[model samples]
Target: MESSTRTGFAKRRRSLQGPFLSEDNIDVQSDVYIWNSLLSGYAKSSMFNEALDVFRRLLNCPICVADSYTYPNVIKACGALGIEFHGRMIHGVVVKSGYVCDVVVASSLVGMYAKFNLFGDSRILALSLQNDVVLCKSLINVYFACKDHCSARLVSENNIDVQSDVYIWNSLLSGYAKSSMFNEALEVFRRLLNCPFCVADSYTYPNVIKACGALGREFHGRVIHSVVVKSEHVCDVVVASSLVGMYAKFNLLGDSVQVFDEMPERDVACWNAVMSCFYQSGEAEKALELFDRRF
Candidate 1:
């Protein structure tokens, strides 16, 4: 343990090293609030190895009980460290802990499986949680992650936004676009546009535009481009890069060049996109010119 962790955590580390406790004998023995706080802090701070050490100690403690809150961050650390074996073991713990469907806990489990590239396991875990019931907000991200567009949409019905949480829609859309399910991504974007309160943001458009480009939806891409010009995120470089790539994908290199040339400023990605567009269009001279010229 580091000195910084001692701020709010004094007994946590010591208590975590008690004796080998079995989950099968879960008669609940100790208050693990401080322990959880400690682990959560370590995992969130990108201290993967430290988080695992704490988790191991927590399991060895005869008095402390692991709950739904305990697994997510530790499992996230497993994913971050690419320890698929440890992650899967913790996943079994999650299942046995009866938090498989827990709204607060399920997303991390699903995301961890995705990180493991066990997409099938991710889908199985998600479907088992639903059990033919309507999908909850947390399960939507991994559904699209496994390329199950129908279930993702089924869960993403406008009614699911009872709290009017834009995060639900954003996660749903991002999952689809990120997994290369372009049509589904567009459908989510359409629904997002229809929702009066669930406004899109800078984080939203690049995935949507990437989806459009992948599907060769030139008309839809152009429509989104016009909307980008009017929206507050127009000046966003990532959105700008996506636009440049979208036009290039549409075989409208002229439009791509125009979008690139008009940028008030450019990042390496934006410059690369424009340069690649020129290079792909057989304009090696322009690409070289851009490469040699740096602001």
Candidate 2:
């Protein structure tokens, strides 16, 4: 009954908001809810700075009290901007407001801490919640961000459902690539190919191709090229660039040249890949020829 009343009140308040504000006669309590709504909307729309702006305004208004919904959005903005001090301030507010136990706000705090590479804090916050899949996923992402692949793998392996999660696979692939663990990245891709749990997408193909290039694994590169073609992502700029780079890195100039020529539209990256291929393969003249034609 109380929930229904609040919802109806919110609906009526939303309708009255513009008129009330225009008249500068909105009640203080309505102003708090309106600010919370604005802050949440801004954060959800990825307008982090604007969310922070509204947050600051809310802070200056003594009549407005920060609620559970308000803290998460504010913390999200702080996280997105990597503002640790502001996040900490919001955390303190959350604790005093007794909102630290709220799952949504807690998850946001965990995610924010993880974003800033505060792995220990993230871990502690994540563990406070039980049977929360969202929190577990955030914890997995935190480990990945920390480059603790062992811990990440452990978490992923322990979570039975995450095995079929494409985002988890993408995170692991990205983590491996970022850490220069090219061989491990390829291995993960190989596993991904065999698993019926998930299928490769544009994001997956490019990273795996990059790993193949780094390892000079021409055969693996060929296999991935076929997969890319079968996946019908051949024209994707990022995948195409990775293919060009992979072929070039293996000194397979002909295949690299063919891929470059086949691109329907060439970006600067494609051109750079073709030129770098020749340059890296000790074909300076060919590299210069391509460079000259690029003008």
Model 1 segments beyond 4 Å from truth? 1-63, 71-104, 108-137, 158-163
Clashing pairs in 2: none
Q: After superposition, how far is residue 132 of candidate 1 from its true place, in Å?
A: 19
Off by over 4 Å in 2: 1-69, 72-108, 111-141, 158-161, 292-295
TM-score of each: 0.62, 0.62
lDDT of 1 by residue, 1-295 (tens): 5665654344444444344123443443355775677678777556678778878878887788788888888988998998999988888888888877677677787778777777777766665665323235667855665556665665545363432566666777788777777887788788788877667888889999999999998999999998888896768989999899888777788999898888887888888888888888889998898788964
Please give, for residues 1-295, the per-residue lDDT of candidate 2 as tens digits.
Answer: 6566555554654454355433355374446777887776666666688788777867776566777778888998999999999999888878888888776787678778878978777665655542455555555565666565665555555444666777767777887888898888888888888777778788888889989888878888898899899899999988998899889888888999999989888889889989988888889999999988889
lDDT of 2: 0.77
Q: How accurate is candidate 1 locally (lDDT)?
A: 0.75
**RMSD from true fold, candidate 2:** 9.8
- Candidates' C-alpha lDDT: 0.75, 0.77
